[model samples]
Target chain A: MQDDAKLIEFIKTDLARGKVTGKLGANDDLIETEILDSLGIMKLILFLENNYAVKISDEDLTLENFTSIMSINSLIQRKRAAQGA
Target chain B: MDFSFTDTQVLQRESIVEFARRELNDKVRENDQAGGFPLENWRKCADMGLLSLLTPEIYGGLGEDLVTTANSLEALSYGCEDSGLVHAIVTQLCCIVLINLYGSPAQKERYLPELSSGGMIAAQSITEPDAGSDVLSMRTRIEGDGAGWLLSGGKVFISNGPLADIIIVFARCGAGKSAFGEISCFLVEKTAAGYSMGKPLQKMGLRTLQNCEMFFDSVGVGEEMLLGKNGHGMFIFNEGIEWERALMTAAHLGTLERVLGKSISYVKTRKQFGKEIGKNQSLSNKIGTMKLNLELGKLILYKMAWLKDQGKRATLEASLGKLFVSESLKSACLDAIQIHGGYGYMQECDLERDLRDSVAATIYSGTSEMQRNIIARMLGI
Candidate 1:
């Protein structure tokens, strides 16, 4: 949960880019709500790879891993843990 | 940062060009006129190891890098007079690269050796009656069976459909989700029951490359045949298309170079008003523009290839390169024909054929409009 706020801020600021109204929840369905398109997903992957230094392979590109800010945060934390181990 | 080819790469390119010229150019006119796929020429390309350029050595391939593979494709297109043949070869290469990238270990062990050696042909079937640019709208359906899947749908405009021994078919696996999670692909063999192919479709250009419609009626495929994970078809497709858009247009680079060379030679030798036509500023300017486009096109293509070789993403670069090279190649082809005058219109002159073939470049591997949309999206517009 350390990076949840950072992940949410990045999605709202960088990806949504003022498209979201009021507040974007951490558990909001990114795909179902159309907040993150295919290109947005690609950009998110690039951001996680560059900012977090966690390499995401094709297998990690599932809908479950990218469904929400919380899910994405979990993915990054898991990748970081794996790297540290 | 260094852009020069290595000594070995330079020699390898030369040998490939020479081999293509000797073996692939035979009866090209006849083959194109008949709209026939040249099986003999395909076998020659396989024997020359052209088919195995990018497959890893573990799978009976040369294990060449992306730059080398692009270089060889450029050389092959330059020396071969048959644009259709070059297109077919590039299509196979795209499928091979896709399988290499996403195939399971068991799938690789079963398919790579034969595909790499050109002992079998493969096609990627994604387009449907209603789906061309809008892939998410495709209606092909795959339903889960006991331990397998039942595929039922039809695909149109499949490049190697007529002759492919195995086809990678994308189908809808679920509903009420985004394209990223709704689509799945399966590897279906030609011998599968209830699978059938329509006759080759007639086309104005690239006539020798056969394109056809395919149908699958409850064709059963084991779960093992599913490529990658379920719901990952769109991702797999996007990844594979980057390679296709980049390297397939590498062949267009060769076509552009050949057209520029021919235009230059004709202008220098052909006389108009008692002087060489090269003396005409208007005509010379066209040739000059052709040269400029070819050079710029090469730079974009190589940059994309270099990005892929470095294990970096090149989605935007690939779209930009595809758009630029495809449009410029069409312009170059037309200029070559115009510069050649009446003689160029003749089928024997071959510039007309090049022009006909160039039209498809803008239309396939994602259209020019789609490329622009991708570029805009990448720019966050």
Candidate 2:
């Protein structure tokens, strides 16, 4: 499975789960746009934790960390590589 | 924004509902009739750490955030029959959350453990016979006596008044001060001298939790009892109220769902005009409206909770949630009563109790009118 494809799918599913609609863009404000409010982030964190097998510490959970599909995918790759995955 | 709870949240919700069902329900009618507080149920809830839903574990609380707390309360309301019992729990939780957020370390050390462990029942006393919704109009005052503060005032419509060991009292200080900025909240213990309760009020609903009046005449407390800054207590009060208004009726969303399901079953099974009442367009439409309200109410409240969990100031969202759910539940309860017909009018089978409980919702924690004011103000209307 391509990581980018899967990440896009995850984001789409999350968007649907929240019943929020908009054109996917790299710069959408997740919270300001009402896309991924508090619970959505928690759910996303849980999803990433399970699927990526990456332990996301409290400090790492930030808007900076998950603002875009590229950001999340890059962070996942970095973490997985650091873990020698 | 997401209506579905996460795994832990779902479990928390289930556990609270189970705890309420196992510990409460059967005794609700008797307690409601007698206007008595549910001491044993209070203990049971505390043992389950139900009271600490909002408090952090650092202060001997569960330390969960707003979403988990909302889920727990929703389940508790769903499984529990006595709105009075649930109201008392909500009142205590509201007060304790403020204590955890703003109280001194000594205050937390003393009260959080006691409250979370069910060592004592708690109350939030701010409504006075005169104060009502215009909080600044409070006649209660805390005089800065040479040896601690002397409290002289009375509060009415206080939930859990008869049972609280420590009641959080909001008072207006500096009589000439600005209307919105000079309020203070104090943690007054029930055992304090000159602190007494009047006969519990016969409430329109939620009677099992012991709604009543309390008088604080020369009630004294040390400097340490002040929660937050003296003049900034309105901040703490409003914070508690925001959380209360947002999450308190969450369980009622589930209650709405339950009532809708009940109504559907009634209309489906019971023969009316030689057919199921649900087959009639009017009855189905009523249930449909109820279902719509229930789903939308849940979405709004959960969104508010999500906002809180993200460190966002969700004042507007919370007000919106409160407005929608409180008004929506009114619709649900009225429909439930209609579906049950004469049986709903009777004192049997919890529809009456549910109706009574819903009546109190539009009034407490900021009335529906007040909620609209907040929402409109937020909208700059």
Candidate 3:
């Protein structure tokens, strides 16, 4: 599995109970697919912050930044670059 | 555990108490009877900087932490006889705080300064007719437009609805999203073409605060109006509820003190059977219980507020605090009325209105039953 897949798996396992309910695709929108309800999204945000050591600021909380696993991974990469990680 | 307030907090509390006592209590009985919200008092509170306690200083706010906000609200409630007006203030302030936390920079630029300065009133639109406690079951929908969204639905029991300039409306979206998944929060201005408000709904208590039903019939909102990202309504709404439950009832803490003081004074002075009512054990025991509830409720509320200030999620603590303080306020009001005997029931004593207002504490920001459900879930029950 790819590194991005690992994060997707984490979200899937915690929020969707490891079930691929057609909403866990790599490019599927977590908010749009209903896989991550509001509370689930919050939990996922915390999960990414804690596991990856990246801060998700309010400006980064938009749909363009968090729509899918790909977007989330890209955001993390950008944040890491910004921090010179 | 240290429960001491900082000197700054103490001074803030004192000034708020003084202001409320001097400016807010006038003609309260007449206003309550007329169901009139005194706009002057609302602006007075704004001028005192009470309107902007939680927003950042750059946005024209006092930017106080949660504990200080709670302390100031408690002092205001203690001094102010107008609980309805305070209720309106909390509703508007809660909306402002949520917007500050979630609004885009542009959205903030448009609304925050006016909201913080009390030049504009804010209200949150939730609690539909079929979806009060079952918030996820709301039927309001937001369909994607070319560069915006079209909202169509109705919201009931909207606090400050009639007077609000901007309303944070929650609506459904997404094709196959779960009930919770499809919801999104939108910023709907009252001037929107299809947006309209019903007349204020008269109530038994908090009469001076205006509440109404709102309708959005294909109201168009640009991308700038979304408070947070789409499908994140519940999270944003939850944030507000958490703060509201944790701190808004700080006023009730003050109300409890007021009721207790009044009861004590009445018991000490009023003579019955050739002696003061304090000579009676039952009445004195009632007072004792009121005191007990006051102390315990304060500790819970203070802890919850402090946790919020530390930027921690205190869902359990907030629920517990809201549950305790609201119920305690009701009981204290009842005891005060009982202690005052027939006179308490009369509008002249104000205990009747206090009791009426205290009853609503169990209903909004999640009912007592819902709070217990949250607590039980947190306990993994």
Candidate 4:
């Protein structure tokens, strides 16, 4: 839940650039809504890697993994779990 | 954290510099003036094993790391007066690196040996008339035929387009407003039916490097020619650009060093008002800034190279480095010309040529404006 809020905030502030003034729901499609383009996705990955202390491989860069805040947070959680294991 | 080159790297740089000085500079001015591609020099570079610097040993390449590759390119740029030749070599190197990174075992076995050995030249065609920086907006379309894919589109401003026997062409393979899961890359041979190249387009600078327009009228490519997975072209293209931005600007380091050395020599020897011109504060300041920019550029570039060597994605660093190094090279070239005064303006002096060549540095790979946009986006601006 905390990761969800942080990811949503990042998308609103950094990726969406204030265009997303209203509440960004966890399930809202970042890609379909055009909030995150290709470059934005890369920047978001860097943020996730640095903030969460996890590495995102090229194979992990998929539309499914980055379509929404929930998806991104889930990806972060998965990477963290993998690291811990 | 260590910035110093290894002993082997140092020797490699020296040997490449020596080879470039000995063989690459001949008829450079004439070739640039004629807007001709120096095929002889290309063959010489291949023979010198420069073409194989980034490929794996199994594919006939030296498999040098990114830092060592950057060092060799820098040395080549420093020693060779022909910026066009250097640019062409870097283009080829980037293509080779891209294929090696993403090519399948079959793809690698088929293309890497010939490309690394300089038996065949390759071009990466992505830019279109409407889509230079906005690559996703490209109109190139690829449809899956019963047997293979049919590529139909045109690419402009393609380096080595005329000379490349194999071209990596990007086309939209899926329906999407976004580049994700839409773009795909194809390795189209020059012999492919309906594939044609226009005559080389004359350019303002880097004239020795050939630039041409490529047209495909339903060119057939086998399924085997697809690079990476379908819909992975955007990722592959971005990765290739990252590498290109980081490593291609290395040649500018050599050019900057050469321009700085020549400017300093001229200012110290040339007399004005009964004294050496370099003694003046204005002249000295300009040279000092050139030195400063050179050092700063080196720091940004070498750090980017080091980051890539550490297996880290350096998209941000690559943009920052490309922005700084390219703009600095342009400024240094202008300062070199100003320091040389009239002699610099003359074609015989070659400072003007460097200035002309420097303009394209800010435009190619990605423009200065594009680099700033990427940096700003990374900063969340």
The whole-model lDDT of each prediction reads 0.88, 0.76, 0.85, 0.88
Q: What is candidate 3's lDDT per residue for B1-381, written digit by digit as tens?
A: 788999998998899999999999989999999998899999999999998998789998988888889888899899998888999999988988888888889888889999988899999898999988666778889998549899999999998999999999988876454433467898988899999999999998999999999999999989888877777677677778889886667988988988999999999999999999988999999999999998998898888888778776667788899998999999999999999999999999999999999999888888999889777644434
**Native contacts recovered, in order, as a fraction for each?**
0.27, 0.00, 0.18, 0.42
What order do candidates take by TM-score, descending? 4, 1, 3, 2
* Model 3 error, position B274 (Å): 2.7
Expressed as tens digits, the lDDT of each residue in B1-381 for candidate 1 is 798999999998999899988888879888989999999999889889988998889999999998999999999999898989889888888888888888899988888899888889999999998988777788999998539889999999999899999999999888755746788888999999989999999999999998999999999989889888888888888888899998877999998888888899999999979999999999999988988888888888999999899898888899999999999999988888889989989999998889999999999988999999888877766
Q: What is the per-residue lDDT of model 4 for residues B39-113, given as tens digits with 9 covering 90 to 100?
A: 988889999888999999998889888888888999999999999999988999989987888888999999988
* lDDT for model 1: 0.88
Off by over 4 Å in 4: B145-147
Segments in model 2 whose C-alpha atoms lie over 4 Å from true places: A1-85, B1-3, B145-147, B177-181
Best-matching candidate per TM-score: 4
**Distance from true location, Cα of B183 in model 2, Å:** 1.6
**Evaluated on chain B only, what is the TM-score of candidate 1?**
0.98
Q: lDDT tens string, model 2, B360-381? A: 8888888888878766644434
DockQ pick, better of 1 and 3: 1
Per-model TM values vs. the true structure: 0.95, 0.78, 0.85, 0.97
Q: Could you give me the TM-score of model 4 versus the true structure?
A: 0.97
**In candidate 4 chain B, what residue range of length 10 has the lowest lDDT sum?**
B173-182
How does model 3 score on DockQ? 0.18
| CA shift of B371, model 2, Å | 1.4
Q: Which runs of model 1 end up more than 4 angstroms from their true locations?
A: A1-19
Q: Give the Cα-based TM-score of candidate 1 against the true structure.
A: 0.95
